[model samples]
Target: MTSTDHDTAPADRTAAGTAPAPAAPARRPRRELAAATVGSVVEAYDWTIYGILAPYFAEQLFPGSSPTAKLLAAYLGFALGFLVRPLGSVLIGRLTDTRGRRYGLTLTVSLIAVGSLLLAVVPGYASIGLAAPLLVVAARLVQGLSVGAENPSVAAYVTETAPGRHRYFYSAVSYGGVVLGSALSFIVLSVLLGVFGESGIENGAWRYGFLFGALLGLTALWIRRGAQESAVFTAAAPGADPAPGPDGAPGKPGGTGGTGPAGAKRAKAPSPWPVLRAHLRRLTVVFAITSGATTAFYFVTVDFPSYAEGTGAATKEESSAALLLGMVALLLAMLGGGRVADRFGALPVLRVGFAGLALGTVPLVLAMSSGRVPVQLVPAVLLFLLGLPLAVSNVFAGQLFPPAVRAVAVGLPTAVAISLFGGTFPMLAELLRSAGHNDWVPWWPAITAAAALAASWGVREHPLPGEPHA
Candidate 1:
C-alpha cells in the first residue's frame, strides 16, 4: 500500500463498510491538554486537602466530647460534599453541553477556589459556636459541586482534544495530574506537621493547606480561560455546521438543516435527559466502571492513613509518608498504564486493573492486619493497581456516548456512584472499625472490583468522528 493508504488503514478498519472517516485536526492540542491537566491538579488538590487536614481541624470545627465524635462529624461533612455532587454534575454538565467546556471549567475552578478560601478562613467553633461547623459544611457543599462538575468536563475536554491515536496516553497524563495534586497535599501537610508539630496542626496550622489550594485553583482558572474549545463540541453544536441531508449531502440552511430560523424554532440545545434515557445501559456501565475504582481509591488514599494510625500499624507521620510515596507510585502507574492501553486497548487494561484489585485486596488487608509488611509497601502497591484503570477510565466513558450529551452522560452516573461508594468509604470504614466489623472493609472494594470486571467485558470503545482507532 502507498503511504497515504497506510495512514488511512486504521480509520478504514474502524469504519468497516461505512463512509470514510473525517480527517483528524491538523494542529496538536498541546495548550488545551496542559490546561486540562492543570485544572485536574487544582481540582484534586482542593478536594483532597480537606480530607488530609480534617483530623487536625475537626476538633476546632465541631463541638464534640471525644476525638472520634469530632472526626466523624468532619467526615460527615466530607460525605455531604459527595451528596450534592450529582446536582453539580447535572447543572454543570448541562452548562458544559450547552455553553462550552472552557466556560464550565472556569466556573468550576472558580467555585473550588471560593470553597477553599472559605475553608481556610472560617472561624473555629471556639469563636463561632454552632456556626463554625455549619460554615464548614456549607463550604464542603460548594466544593462538592465544583468537583462534581469538574471531572466530567475535564474528561470530555481531554477526550475531544487528544490525538486519536494517543488518547489513552493523554488521559493517563491528565490522571497523573490528579495524583500529583493529591501528593502535593501530602507534601504540604507533611511540611506543616514538620514546621508546627502535631499539636500546632491541631491548634490551627491546617488552614494553610486550604489557602494554598485556593491559590492553585485561581492559577488553574486562569490557565483554563486560554484553552480553545474542543473541535468536536464545535462541530456538534447547533448551527455550527450544516446538518446532513437524507443522502449525506449538507442540507440547506433553514430548510433541512438543523440550524438557522427553523432549527431555532425547534430547540436551543439538546436535552441530556432523552439521550441519557436512551443510553441507560451505557449509563449503568459508567456507574459500574466507576464504582470499584472510586471506592478503592478513596479507601487507599484518604482512609488508610488514619486506619493505619488507629490500628497501630503505623504512626500518623509514618502513614502520611507512606501515602505520599503511594501517590508517586500511582502517578507512575497511571502514565505507564495509559501508554500500554494506547498500544493495546483500554478494555484489556481495565480488566487487568479490576481483576488485580479483586484478587489483591484480601491479601493486602491480611498483610496490613499481620503487621509484617512495611506500611508504605501495601499502599504503594494498592494505589499503583488503582491508578491503572483510573488512567483510562474517563476516556473509556467518553467513548460510550456522542458529544451531544457526553459530559452529562459521564458525569451524573459517575457522581452518583462516587457519592454512594467513594464519598462514604472513609466514614463507613471508621464506623465499621468501631463496630468490630473492620475485617469486612476489604471486601467492599473487592466485590465492587468484581462487578466492574464483569461490566468491562461488555464495554467497547468507539472513536469520535474524524479520529483514528487506537
Candidate 2:
C-alpha cells in the first residue's frame, strides 16, 4: 500500500473489515551493533585466556602431575567449563526472555569478570594443595556460563538491530570481534610470556593473562550497560514496556506494546515445552550449524597448536605466533564475509564457508600434522578455508527464528552443540594425538563441516526472518 493509504486507513482496520497491517521492522543503528559485539569480544577474551596459558601453568596449578598429565588436567578443566555452558544458557536465556536483553547482558558480563578475577588470584598447588585446581575449575565454570549466555544474547541483539539488507553481514561482524579478542588475548599472553619467560610463567606469572581478561570483561560491561534493549525483545516481551533502558528512553528504533484504548493485551512469553515443541526442526538446524562452527573453531584455534607442536612442525612459540596471525587473517576474512554475505546472500556465503571447511579441514589438519611444512603455512590455510567460514555463524543462527524465543532458541542449541562439540573437540583431539592417531583428527571437524553444509542447504537464501522479499 502507498504511504498515503497507510496513513489515511483506519487506525485498527479497513472499512471492508480486514485487520490492520503489521508495522515494518525498523532499521537499527550501527552503534548498537558495536555495543552488542563488545559483549562477544569480552566473552572471547575471558574464555580463551586460560587456554592460551594452560600449557605453561599446568604444573603450577596441578603440581606433581607429569607434563602430559598436567596439560591433560588443564584441558579437562577447560572442557568441563564448557560442559556447564548449556545450563548457563538456559538460566541466562530465561533471564533475557523474562527480564530483557539489557539486564541479562549486564549480569552476564559481571559474572565473566568475577570468573576471570578468581582465576587470576587463585593460589598455587604448593600453597593451597587441591584447592588450586578446585579454584581453577570453579573460575572456568563461571566464565563458561557467562559466555554461554553472552554469545546468543549478543547475536540475537545484533541481528535484531541490523538493517534488513545487511542482516547476515551484521551478524557475522561479531565473529570479527571474537577474532579481535583472540588476537588481543594472545598479544597480552605473548607479552607476559616474553617478559616473564617459561619459568616465570610457571611461577605464577600466568595470572596476568586472566587479570587482563578481567579488565576486558569490565570494559565490556561498561559498554553494554549503556546499550539499549534489543528491539526484537522489546517488541516481543509481554507485561514489559518496550523501552529496555532504565530511563525509559528508547535507544533502539522499534518496540511494540499493548493496543491503544481498546485495552487489548498482547502475547506473553510462552512456556518452554510449547516453544520447544514448536521449533524442533529449527533447533536441530541450529545444533548442526553450531557444531560445525564450534568444531572448526576449536580445531583451528584451541587444538591446532598442540597438534602442530606435537608433530614438531612448529615449536610452542612458533605455534602461538601462527595462531595470532591466523586470528588477524580471520578477522579480515570475517569483515570480508560480512560484505560478501550482504552482496550475494547469507545462506550462500554460509554454504561457501561450510564448503571450504568440508574440503579443506583434512588437508589443513594434515598440513599442520605433517611436521614437514613451514610453520606459517597453517595461518594461510586458516584464512582461506575452515576458520574463515565461521564468520557468518551468528547471523546464520539469528536468521532462523523470531525474537520472542530468539535468545532461547539460539542459546539452547548453541549450548548443546558447543557443549557437545566445541567444548570437547580440543580434548578429543588431544586424546587422539596422545594415542598416536594423528591421521584421525581431521575427521572430527570435517564431519561437522559437512553437517553445517547440509543445515545451511535447507535454509532458503533470503532476507531477515519475517521480512517480506523485495
How do all models score by TM-score?
0.88, 0.87
| Model 1 spans > 4 angstroms off | 1-28, 241-267, 461-470
Q: Which candidate is the best by lDDT?
A: 1
Candidate 1 clashing pairs, residues 3+ apart or interchain: none
How well is each residue in 197-258 modelled by candidate 1, as lDDT tens digits? 98998998998999999999989988887676666665566654333334332232223344
Runs in model 2 deviating more than 4 A are 1-28, 243-248, 251-268, 367-373, 464-466
Per-residue CA lDDT of candidate 2, range 1-470, in tens? 22321111122223466664433323335767777888778888778777878887898898554788888889889999988888888888777766677777888889999999999899889898999999999998988888888888877777666666666567767667777777777788789877998888888888888888888888888887777565455545564333222344332221244432245554456676576767788888888988988887777777777777777687777887888777766777777777787777667667777888888777766765665567677765655554445666776676677666677778888998988998777778878888998678778888888988898666566664336531
- What local distance difference test score does each model get? 0.81, 0.73
Candidate 2: clashing pairs of residues: none
lDDT of 2 at 250: 39
* Prediction 1 global C-alpha lDDT: 0.81
